[model samples]
Every structure is written in C-alpha cells, then in structure tokens.
Target chain A: MIVIDTWLYGELASYAGEDAQPGFAQLKIELPDGATMQDLLDEIDLPTELRGITFINGNLSAMPGKQHDLTQELKDQDRVALFHLRSMWPYQYRQGAAMLDSFNDEIQKDGDRGIHHAFNG
Target chain B: MWFLRINMKDRTHQLTEVPEKYKKLAGRSLTSNLIADEVPPLAHPLGPNNKLVFSPGFVTGTSAPSSSRISVGGKSPLTGGIKESNAGTPWAWKLGRMRIKALIVEGQPEDKGEFWGLVIGLDKETGQPTLEWFDATEFTGQDAYDVYPMVFKKFEGRRVSVCGIGMASEHAYGNAGVIFEDMSQNPSRFAGRGGLGSVMGSKGLKFILLDDAGAPGVEIADKELFDEGRKKLAAALNEHAITKPKGGLNTYGTAVLVNILNEAGGLPTRNFSRGRFENAAKIAGEAIFDGVKERLGEERYNHACSPGCIIRCSNTWYRKDKSEHVSCVEYESDWAFGANLEIDDLDTISELVKLCNGYGLDTIETGVTLGVAMEAGVLPFGDGEAAIEMVHKMGKGEPIGRILGSGTGTAGKILGVVRTPAVKGQGMPAYEPRAVKGIGITYATSTMGADHTAGYTIAPEILAVMDDLDPLSKEGKIALSRAFQATTAFIDTSGHCLFIAFAILDIASGYQGMIDEVNGVLGTKWTADDILELGTEVLRVERKFNEAAGIGKQADRIPEFMHTEPLPPHNVVFEIDEETLDKVYGEL
Candidate 1:
C-alpha cells in the first residue's frame, strides 16, 4: 500500500535504504486505526512536481494532491493505485516508466514462455 | 552468357547463362523472387536445403544517383521464414556493371571440416567477381576487411567489393550479419539482419568478393531525361535541412531520434516494460557526441554508411576513457540497445554496438533479444556488463549464447520469460508499439518480420507525412501502412536509400525522378502508378511463398504480450483491431 509518482524518483529504487525512505523519514507518522486521506502525503517528503488525479479502487478522486486514509480495515491483498503523471487523452503512459509493466512481470513470474506461440488461439 | 554459381559442398564453381525470365528482375525484386521460387519454407535454414542469392538492381553501376544497393536473399535462420535484406555499398554496383545478374551460392560442406574464405577480385578488363581461396580462418580469424588488402595487393591494389562472415556468423546465430567492405576498405556496411550471414556461412564460403574493374555503366533509354530528373531531385534534397549536409542526420545521425522519441513518449525502456527511461538525456545523442568529443575529438563525429550518401547521419564514437566504442551508433541502435536495456550509459551501449558489428550481427536484433533475456532473469535487467558478456559468448559459439543469439522467440523458450516483445520471431525496434499506433501497424503487417524501416509510418503518424492521425487511433493506419509498405518496396527495389523517400515523396517532381530512373534503366515504359503495381507484385510473390511454406494468416499476427500488456508513459495496449491486420493482405 505504497504510493508515489513514478517520474519523481523511479531509478532511485537503488536508494531504498536512504534517509528519505518511508520509515527513515523525519516526518514519518503511524496511520491511525481509521485515519483519512490527508494524513499520507503530509508525512513523507513527496516530490512537489508530481501533478495529476489519483485513483482509489479504480474510482477517480476529486482532491488528488491531498492524502487518503488507508488504515480502514484493508484486506491483506487490497490493491491501491497511484496514477503516475502522464498523458491520458488518446493513450496514457508514465514518463520515465520502466518498459516492462506490472502485467508483464506477472506473466514473466508465471514462466509462460509459450504464450507467444499461441497467438492464433 | 553470364551466370555464376558457387557450390559450397564440393568447393567447385560454375559459370552459365542466366534465363530470360530473370532478365526483368534485379536487386530487391530479384532477391525476393529467387527466395520464393527456389527455397522450401520448411527447409532447415542452416542446412544445405536452403540457398543464398545476391543480386544488384538493374540500374546498379549506373551514374544514376544512389544506384548502388545490393539485395541478399535466403530462408532466414532468425525468423524461420523467408527474407530479402538490402544494403547500400559499392559492391552491388561493382558486381552489376560486370553484367552479372545474380550469384547463387548453395549447399553445405560435404566434410563439415575446417572453415574456408573466398577471395574475389577483378581481372582488370572484365567487371566480374573472380574467386580465390584464403586460409584466414586458420590464422587470427581475419575477415573480409582484413583479408581483402592482402589479396588486393597481390592484384596490384585494384578496387574490389568483398563480403565475408565473422566468428558469430560462422556459428549461425540468428543475429549474425554479412559484412561488406566499403569504398574506403572499411567493413562497416552490412547486409545485416535476418541471419543472412549465417546463410552464407552455412554454404561453406566465408566470403563472396566482387571485383568489377571494367564494369560498363548501366544503359538508360533517355540520357537527357534521366539527367534532368537527377538534377531536380538533388536540388530539392539540398533545399531541405533534414536531407542537406550538416542537417540533423549529417550532424547527429539517427541518434537524434533518441531525444525526439523520448519527448514523444515512444522510447521503449526495460524490455518494453515501459515507454520512458529516467536517464534518457544522459544517453542522448548530444551527450554521446560530447563524450566522444572529450575523448576522440569532434572530427571523428561525422561519418557515412556508404559512399555517395548525401545525408551523413552516422558517426564514430568513443568512450570517456578514449576507447573506441562503435563506429556509427545510429538512432535505432542507440534506443534499441540503450534505453531499451534500462542501462542509460551511452558508452556501454556503444561498446556493445561495436561488439555486435565486429562479430557480424544485427544491432537491433541482438539488442531486442538481450532485452528479452534480461526479462527472463538469465541476466538481471539493466546489467550492461552482463549483456556485453552474453554478446561475446555468441561470438565464441557457446550453447547458452547460441540460444539467445537465435533471437527473442527462441531465447524466450530457453529462458522462461513470457513477456517477450517480438513479432514473427523477429525482434521489435526502438519505438514501443503501444506508444505509437501507426508504427504498431507497421510491425504487425510488414512482410519483413517486426522491421521498422520496412514501413516507417512514424512520419505520417507523428510528423504528418500527408495526413497526421492521432497515433493511438486505429483509423487510417491500415491505408497508411499499406501505402508506406508498397512505396518502401518500390524504393528498396530501385537501389535507392529509404531516407530519400522522406523528402523526395513529398515533392511531386522529386519523387517522379526515382520512377524515371527505374523506367530508364530497365527500358520499360512506366509511370508512378506502374511503380505501385510492381511493388504490389513484389508483396504478392513474397506472400504466396510464405503461404506455400506454411506461414498463413495466423503468422502475420502480433505477439500476445503486446496485445495483453499495457505499456507505460502511455498506459495503452495495441488498439488495432485484428480485422485491420487481416485486411493488409486484401489488395495483394
């Protein structure tokens, strides 16, 4: 249940152990049992240049820049999405996004190499 | 009385008369026709069952501008399908002037013993390729470029066109390419890709050198009309900054497309997993130039792929350590191996580019295949050093390297990676299809497997060649792809470079000059419309052969991963409907 705009710090995954990492941040605050959206972005050193609408459970949120509450009895495998800053009219893609996406990783994880040969199917 | 056939099995050669039917077809057209008529689709690509043919266009060796292209045809080891690849070099024109219509090299070695090389030179008065034997493979594995000078000195320093296979090609890797000596005695130009060099290597002949010393200029029916046409076309090319000397191409070459495509959000990074690379600017053409300038000096930046090329969009680059990286890192190679690998270091990509070239392999194919291998975790993604090691293994003919060298399709099978981005067993180029829809259609429909240069719809899709359509929209791509593919076939077959089409096709008179050259050389009366018909005929013949070889409507479809995965920078999957893909073959 982590959310950050992709373009802000994509290749910085190598800096996972740095001072700005979630737990190591000076402003880090544990979410309340029923804390709301505004409590999230206020805690971490989120990049200010990230601008766009945010999605929660596939529904668009009116106030995207503000944080949301996530401690509301969420399931272990609940999916949360942060729409990266990108163009979405004709098509939507993240600037500086990795070429291989989540779905590709899923299929790659499954080791289904024969999937391409079944194109006619 | 002008036919030459080299039988690789017995190390014997024969000279006979070419048939009348073949008189009309030459260059790209001749290559494709020979592949269709002679090769069995089911035949083992590396076995003696397949045949390799080389033919220059009918107008080749003429004073006509840009009339020095050669065509290489064979059943491809990479795609497991038929292919006819074309390249620009003095060799084709040299061979054509000798009235040599075609060179048919066939059969594998009977012994499967040690390898051999073919040394060819002119007899001074006759412009024909004469054969000699070289034991270069026995000593240092010297290639055509290295072997030619020694033999050329023996022939009194005569100019010759030599084609040879390097270490990787002799190993029959899918990415292996045939290297041809340029006018300056450099083995820089290649009839590369589609495993054409492997086809040559399988024939037991390491090289096919052409020394057409007394080659006569091509005959044209109307000299004045042709000259006038050439004058008009040259002037128009000079007018456009893109085609003119010192333009974007001449200055930065195709590598300029790196920054432009990144800004457009079409650059494929990390094995088609995303469309954008964070460090793209670090590997930008300008940065690469700066790196080279700091090391090799600025004078080394400007180069050309061949002689008589107006647009010198190529360069020889060096690393910050002042080491030679690659001679010419074009735009596609930069993106295909650079951003696509998630290794934004230009120097690393440059070094890998040289390794592929020196080993006689296609940069695009090797890059894309390596991208898939990274996804498979055979080597970690963005591991530039590991990728270079794998490429080196391919040169040495190692087993794992062989599997990867077969291209993405086979590589995917060997390593368990399902998200292999390719079409028809051939690897995709720089642009991710999900970002650029028109290019997507080109990949899906081009007869040449997953090739971008075959039908570059990017101009019409993004730059607006005639009508700019939204790249993501499926509308009008069918028509655009067909027209572009047909027109490309015409240009490729005419022995002219495709870059000329960008400026020439836009101008009415400039475009007509190419058609005029085609008509004048063959002595055939034809207009622009006839060119379309001839192009369409070429497609039909190729398609018919594919069908005969068991590649049907099913084979033309794109890989499943592209349709299923949503590429980022633009979270869009391929939106082109299947019916549109099927409709591409409608006219043919």
Candidate 2:
C-alpha cells in the first residue's frame, strides 16, 4: 500500500465532508498491476477540465491536459498533490510541463525516482 | 502636466505648473514626494495637517496598454504612516487626458459633516480644466452602491468620471477606501487600502467629478516611438501565456492564486491559525470560472475593470433569477472573509464583498477584522449567514459595527486576540507568513504596512514568473523582496496596472517595452538601472516620511504570534531573523 495523503478540490471537495481536511488527507491506497498516473486519477474521480495541475513528490506530473498528453507511470512512496487550476499563463504551464517531462525521463532512465530528483521542497 | 491643488479648509481650488524637480515624478513617486515635502508626518492622519494626493501614473493617459491607474496617497489612519493606494478605472484615464498630473486635497472643513464636491471642466480661456468646489450634502448618507444613480442623475448632461465614499468612510472607519466607477459604470474599482477614504471624508470632501468634453487628451512627445514601444509591449502581452486574452487571470481571475497557494500550504485559513483551508477549491478561481459558465446568461466572466486593460481579469456574478450580485471578487477578499472566517460558501462571500464595496471598506482589512471578531466569539467560525448579517451593521455604524470598521489590528486589540494576523497596524493579505517566507519578508519590510502589492514576491516564489525560488526558503528572499519592491514602486507611478509585472518579469521584451514607452512619452533616455533608482527614491521618500511618523527599522515586524505559532502542512514560524528583515531597505 502506498501513502495517498492528498485532499480533493473544486466539486470533489464539495462532495467530501465539511470535516474532510483539505490538504494532505492521509489515506493508504493500493494500485493494481501496470498502473499509470491516469489510473490514480481515475480512482480519485476528478473531472477532466477541473484537473488543472498535479505534482508527484514535489515535482509536476500532470496539468490541464485538454491541450496536452500527460499520462505517466506511478511509483511507490510518491507524494502526489492535485489541483483544479495552475495559472492563466501559458509559459508557466509550459515550464511546468518541461520539468515533469524531464522528471519522467529520469524515472525511465535510472529506474530510481527519488524525491531529491523531483523537488527539494 | 499640472497639479490641481484644492484647499478644503477654504473650499478653493487651483491648477499649478509642475515644479522643475517634479517634472519626471508622477503616480506613486509624485504622491510620496509631495507627502514627504508638504504633509507633516507626525500630524494625525485625520487632521487638517495631512494631505490627500491623487495622480495618474506617468503613462496613464497615453495609448499604452494596461496603463490607466490613479494613485491615491496620504498619511494613513489605518497604519498611522505613509500610504499609496490606487486602482484602474475610466476615472484615471480621464484625468490623464486632461493633462492633470496630480490632485492634492488638503485642510478640513470647520463645521462637522459639511461635505463638498469638486467639478472640473475645460476652461474657455486656456482650453485646460477649471476646478470648482460645491456643497454635496444631499448624497452624504447613502451607500456607495446606491449613490451611482444619484451621481449619474446629477451629472446627467456632462461627460465626466466620478469617484467618492459612502457611510463607512463618512463615519470615519479606519479601513475605508475610495470608490471609483468601473467600465460598467458600477462603483466597483477602488484604491482600497490604508483608510485614505476616511482622510477624504474627514476633510468633508465627498467626491471629485472630472468632465473632459473639450480635452485633447495627453500629448505624445514622440508619437512614432510611443507607437513602436506600444506595439512591442502589446505583442509581448498577447504572446505571453499569462497576459494573453483568455490566459490564466482572464479565465480564472486573481482568485487563481487560491489553489496554488493552498497546494503550497500557504493559503491562510481560520485567521492564520492554519496554513491551508479545508475547502479552498470551493471558493477558488476554477470554481468561480465553472460557476460563471453554468450561469452563462445570468453570469459572465472576462470583463475589463479598466477601459484599456487587455488582460480582462475581472469577472461578474449573478443570481439564478438573473439579478446582478457583484462583478468581481478577488483572492484576498475571498480568502479573508471565506477561508479566514472558515466560511466556504462563495455566493455568501460575494454578498459580503458587495457590503464591503457598498460601505466603501477595504475588504482585506474588514474581513480580517471580522475574523478577529470571530476569534473573540463575537461571531462563530464557519457561520456564513451571520458574517453577512454583521456586514450590514458596519455601514449603519452600530456599536459592534464601529469596532469592526476600526480595522483588523484595532479589532484584534479590542477583542484580545493575541494571535492577530496583522503587521504595522495593518492586516496581512491572503498568503500566510509562516508558510511563505519570501512574502513574509515583504510583509515585514514594506513601507505601506503589510501590503502584498508592495513587493509581491509571489511572482518569483510561487507563480514562477521570475526565477524559481523555494517559497518556504529564507535564502535570497531579502534581496528578492527589496528588488521587487523597488520595481513595484516605479511601476506604481507609471500608471500601468501592477499585473503587467507578471509578463514583464517573465518575458524580456515585456520589461523593455514598458521602459521604452515611458521614455518615448517623456523624451528621456533611462536605462533599467534608472528605473530601479526611481523606485528606490520613492521608497526612500516614503521611509523618510514613515520615520517621522514614528515607524523605523523597529516598526518593520510581523505579528508576535507569527513568530511563535507554527503553521501546519509546513510547520514553520516566521524564522527570518529581525536583523536580516531590517536589511531589506538597506540600499534604499
């Protein structure tokens, strides 16, 4: 079981209880075989457009994907953060995408996806 | 450009040529310079000794895009120090076109509640505006929201822009703000900090209406160069991701900061008792965007608050019955009244915003005040309905309402809230100081007293508009905050909207385009270093005034509670030492 200590937002937060703490809602989850980033999203059940940006272990993994493909493989001990919107600026989105693309390439290249490689924060 | 000086004590007005030393000074720089030179810093903010200065930025009236802001400056009743608050509206553009650089209002009426108004029109002798003051006692008791019809009716046959206060300001609320008519002619846009409106109201001045029927607008020094710079800046704006037509702010409004701050554990919740809100996304930008989409015919998004702003970030909300509720609600306003109060209902928060606008109160200060009131159990946490009810009383000047109107710092003292989230007698903005150390430096060191726009380290720290720095880190924040503050001081004077900084900071051409346009109009060759120098001079002038006002390096402080209390998610206090914080204004 991997630690899924993340809270929902937007419409999903509305469905979550008033006492459903917003950030870092700690819950252990089990991922099935060959589970990708898309699988974790499907299990969480947030809408398509509402999924503005996402970060795994302090590094960006997905964004408002109406204009881009962001599906990636999931790794254990990855602290994932979900959001409904990032910014209106395209460059900010582009830079975030670049960072995530590189992070994913590292996971594939070295087979060691550490938090240090993802983010220092 | 000329300075319009109005003596409220004798009810006389005059237009004077700009002094040689002040030819290049305008907007925030001009306001600060005049206040430092003229107004007695030690004088009571509400007394006759204090002066109110309103001026458009250097590029305000020209064809420069997103450059139509009016700076309102004075010694603040809220912070008891120097202050400059501004807003973008048609009101400022009209001032710029009339070649009126600044409007200085001084002195006070001998009689109590003897309100007055100033009307400006073209002088047949010189083709410039002639200023006149008249009694405006009839509209004294009305709410700002309801005074729009009366203003339009009174100026029925004239082409003028009107701005003033309401019952809150008239009653001398410390958190009061000046109200201006937006593009929709709604009394919406505001110079909404430092209780400057109370200073105006205390002078027995209700409003100033500028009618520019025969005005030729501002003259361009080098029209060709101006156009070139304008084109470059426009291209940079249009091409950029954030400043593009339907970009982040235009789509989500400034409320976009909500989720991002929350994700970073910086969204101040429950009056800074916690770092993040449990229902942040419910009242965030995406939710607002979605709500507007659902109520498309009833509600609309992407409206411009100022006439020439291309990145129309302002939004409008309406009831299901198609009645307009409010046009736009911002991040700080929502966070203060919504998350800080533990009230998640967006519609309810909007209603509260309407009350703040109606009463002419600073929503951030008032919301933080209300949160402090809640901390003392005057109002319950998460009680949206009760919060709205209390808002009505503020304008009415009820006993409890007056306490609320006094601003968050005073309210905290009255309520005995030890953990009050205020610095230098002003409440903090949306970001929690404990969670975001860079902003923490800004909140402590800004001359204007805990104002986010005073420095806005968020661009680099969180939004990544500048080079990415850890929001939670202390390294290089003092220098970063000071540099941004200096740039912001200069930008605030240029009459350009501060949002331009996002594009200018990110795109190299955007920054050059801004400086080139200012120089294009003035026919002066100023490098980027010169702009930074101008910004530094503005801060120096303000710091000088603040020093005389009894605010010095000692006054540069966050709340004691912030220094002790550890905010959750990132369990950190405001750990940046006082010595380093003091160094923020070192070069300036």
Candidate 3:
C-alpha cells in the first residue's frame, strides 16, 4: 500500500473531514499501489470541479476548467495539494514553471498558447 | 492645466501653463519622460541635480472606475536608475481634479536637516494652484501613522489628502517608501519601491497636503464617449468572476495568490532557498479571510483602497480582541515577512506590515533584507520576535538597523551572505525567479529593478496575434515578456489600477473601454496598436536613461545565486540565456 500526503486549502479544507483546520487540512491516506489521481479523489470524496489549482509533488497538474490529471497516476509518499476555485496564478507568474507532461501538452495545443487568466474547458 | 514646480532650495514655487509636449502625457508616461528630459542621468540620486516628479493618470478624477493612481518618478537611490513608483490613493484623484498636469520638486535645501511642508490649494480667482510652505521640522523623526492624523487635523474642515515620508526616509534609507493616506486616513498606501521616498527626504520635503475643495473637476473632451467607456469597464469589473462583487479579490484580497504560488512551487521561501513554504496556507489570503471571520465573529469583505475602486481588494486584519491590527497585509508584504522568514502567525505578519508602514520602509525590501540577515546568522529564521525587534531598531536608526536599511544588496554584502536575491540592487518580490522563468526574465530586464508588476499579463487575443509565438520557447517567452511590459506601461499611464488588467484581459469590451476612456479625455484617436507603441516609447526613454546612468544591458541579468543555486520543489534554476534576456529590450 502507498500512503499519499494530501493537502486541501481554503474552503476545500472541509473536504478533509475531522482533520480539517481553519484554513487548510493535511492528511495521509493509505491507498493501493498504482492508484491514479481519480482514485485518490474518489477516496477523499472531493468533487473534481471543486478543485481549481492542483499540484502533484509540487508540479502543477491542473487549473480551473482544465483538469487533465484525473488519469495521471499517483506514487507512494507523493505530495498532493488542491486549492479552491477563487485562487489564481496569473499567466505571467507561471509562464515557464514546472507542470505535468499531460498538462503542458494541453496548454501547448491551446490557441493562445495557454496565456490566459483562467481556462474554461 | 498647469505644471507646478516647487524649488526646495529657496522654498519658492512656480505654476506655468502645461507645455504642449506634456499635455498628452500623464502618470508614468509624464513622470518618466519628464525625468528623462530634465534630470541628469549621472547625478547622484540624492544630489541637487536629481528631481522628483508626480503626475496623475488620464481619467483619474473622472467617473472612471478604479482610476485613482499617482505616478512618482525620480532617479532611484537604491538602483541608481530611473524609477516610477505608483500608488492608488485619493491624493491622485485630488491632484487630477485640481487640473495640475505635474508637480515637480527640484533642487535641495542647503541645510538638508530641516524639512518643510507644502500645502497646495486652488486659487479661487485665478483657478490656478497655490502653494504655501511651512516649517515641518517638528513632524520629522516620528512614525507616519502618528503624523497622518495630525496633518489631516491641521487642514480640518477642507477636502484634503496627505502624502509624507517616515523615519526610514528621514534617515535616507535605501528601502524607504513614500506613504500615502488610505481611505481610513491611515498611512498604509504607498508608492513603495525603488527608494523614491528617500529622494523626497533628500530634497528636504516632509509632506505634501492637497486641498482640492472648490476646484474644477477633470476635463473630459467628450462626455458621452467617456460615459460609454466608463460604463463598459464598470460592467466588465462587475461581471467578471474574479473581479465581481464578493469575488476572489473582494473576498480575500491580493493575498489570495499565496497558496496558488505556493502550490505551483513559485513562492520564494527562507531567502529564496526553496520555492514552497510549509506554512504557506496559514499566511495566505484565504487564511486572512477565515482568520478575520473567526476573530470578528462575522464574515467581512474587503474595502476599496481609493475612492472609486469597484474591485476593492484591500483587507484588514483584526486582533484577538476584535480591534483592527492593520488595514492591510498585501501579498508581497505578507510573504516577505511570513513565508520568507518562516513565520506562520498572521498577527506577527500584520505587526511587521504595520511597522513598515509606520516607519515608511518598503516591505519587500525590508523583508528580503531580513532574509539576507537571517542567512548571515544575524538572527535565526522563524524568530518573529527578533524580526520585530530588528524592524524597531531600523525605525530608530541604530547602526545595525541602518545596515539593514541599506536594502537587500547592501545588506548581503555587509553581512557576507553570497546568495542575495537582488537584481539592480533592489530585492526581489514574492515570486521566485528560478521557479518562474518568464518572471525571471522580467525581473532581470525590467527598467525598474525586480518588479512583478513590470510585466503583467494582458489580453490573450492581443498576444495570439503576435506572429504565432509559442510561449514555451525562449524567443517566444522573450517576445511575450516584452509585450507584457509594454502593455503594463500603457495601463500604468491610464490612471487605472493595474488590477484592471485582470478583467480587461479577459473581457474584450473592458479592454476597449480603457482605450476609449483615454481617447475621450485626451481627444486623440488612439487604437490598441497605439497603446502598445506608446508603451514601447516609454520603455525606450527609461532604457536610454538607465544606460546613461551606467546600468546597461550588462546590468540586466539575474543575480549569480539565482542562476547557480537551484530552488527546491521544482529544483530549477533560471535557464534563460543572456542573448534571450537582451532580446526583451533589444528588439524594442
């Protein structure tokens, strides 16, 4: 079994059940080996739409209206963080930052080269 | 319109007709162009040859939404480069209403120790500005928080606004900021980077009080067109999800970016040692929102920083007893003292912000300086109490305090810390350059040193048409950064807050509304292309001045530490080459 270290921020902290703090919640969830991001979401019962910015081991995997990480597999001891919809990382601040291969591909295929305030997919 | 020049050497003032050349310029365009034309590039930033200029943006005093911005420009004591620091305040609105194109302070008092206050009011008969000088010696050497209310009471019963410097400026600290009064009369709003406050202090000026009662309002060339543009911009601001009522900004303030950047591994932590902070969530905008609700026993929305800001993004932090601790803890200020120092407590962060506001120091510079101090073993990281004590000593002008007050670059050198995260002698803001390569390019190449706002993102439609540039490539990123910088220059000149860029970039009409409003006021036919061209011209003028001041392209490189030392989380160093860095300003 693999234990995933997870964090939920803002209003999403309530999704962590009794482990939730005022502003954030952190929990370690034991999951079967080779579980994907979808399975982790199902385990936590956090609706996919509720998360805006998601990071897997500190690498951006998804943004609001752009969720390409559902099928991306999670590893043991991996750090996963989820933020509420109101949060923003403007394009200029995140232009050449690290991102999941699937997410970077999605951005490259976009018409404006993914230079937007928010993507409505 | 008039050009009011105050000669500090003799305490005399002159009001002249606005020159035809300057009539079309306002805000940063006016300030930068005026500085380029008048001030000698090689002059010592604090010397007699350096002049400080202030101008309000176009449409500032009109019915435009969120357009209360003032641009303060001079040679920077910190960077030794041309600088235009901006703030949103009613002081800018008042200046615009008085029809003063620019207020320039020139020459310096021989004594240097004595300070004078300048009271500017409209001459009822002539409809021109009148300036009266007073001995402001008594007001110096005190917290600006204490001085603001006294200045307001001194001009009681009039429509007045106050702008002053604090103890930091009085001591000629390189990190000093010019303090402007907020809506609540607190000296919290600031034109807070590049050491413009020290320039003002060096001129022997303490306060500039504007009383615009009975003054004619801003002249709109075409009222109908102006109203049309204003309504469009207002609708965009009201309808946009992030900018609407009770939206991201109004709900949580600019500190909202804390968790976002932290999650993306872009937040600078512990003197740029890492990209992520363990306690980032605790110090984020969402945390501020929740903390305020828990303390005040109710959910509280943010308030406007200036008179006409619809997307009010300024939040207040309250104590455990429900009293106001501070009017704001901006994202930069919060991160500078919080995650950057490894402090997770909101109360401690608010106290540091309040101290910086009172002492008139730039929060980014102070926090980064403290980070370097920590790296030097002057104090341990996460020691909030020690950090607070150091800030107090800085305000008191103690020897150690003065060393830190010299800013990040100077402090790093003095303390023998080699990993200083500074570009052009100014400390970097909340964003880690190594993690975010485009912002790194901006920090390295911006005429103003290490400014995040220097290259704000604009409309993707505008960007899409830029010759099929792929944002992932080095050339594409440089082109994009140059375009973003030009767009920011235009917005800075428009008198609207840079926050407007958030809504306008997404809504097409909102972008047009900005251009139309400027044309409505100036009666000039300016298209989107003209906006970019004008911004480019402003950059050229600034770059020319910086080059002459000995900060040429060679100085346009990120710190050696950022290039060699990899940031954790992503573990990426700034990989953009020098040739690409030059292209940011080369093609311009």
List native contact recovery per candidate, as a fraction of 1. Answer: 0.00, 0.11, 0.78
Interface RMSD of each: 14.9, 9.5, 1.1
Worst 10 residues of 1 chain A by lDDT: A112-121
RMSD of every candidate to native, in Å, equals 10.9, 5.6, 1.2
By lDDT, the best candidate is 3
lDDT of 2 by residue, B334-440 (tens): 89888999988878999999988888988999888888898899999999888988988888899999998988888899889997888788988987777666677
List DockQ, one per candidate, in order.
Answer: 0.03, 0.15, 0.77
Superior candidate under DockQ, 2 versus 3: 3
- The positional error of residue A7 in candidate 1, measured at the CA in angstroms, is 14
* Interface RMSD, model 1, angstroms: 14.9
lDDT of 3 by residue, B281-365 (tens): 8999989999999998999999999989999999999999999999899999999999899999999999999999999999999
Question: Candidate 2 at B488: error in angstroms?
Answer: 0.4
Docking class of 3: medium
Q: How many backbone clashes does candidate 3 have?
A: 0
lDDT (C-alpha) at residue A14 in model 2? 46
> TM-scores of the models, in the given order?
0.79, 0.88, 0.98
lDDT by residue (tens digit), candidate 1, B340-458: 88887777888787777667878888888888888877788788899889888876778888888888777877787788877778888887777776677777776778887776321
Q: In candidate 3 chain A, where is summed lDDT lowest over 10 consecutive residues?
A: A109-118
Best by TM-score: 3
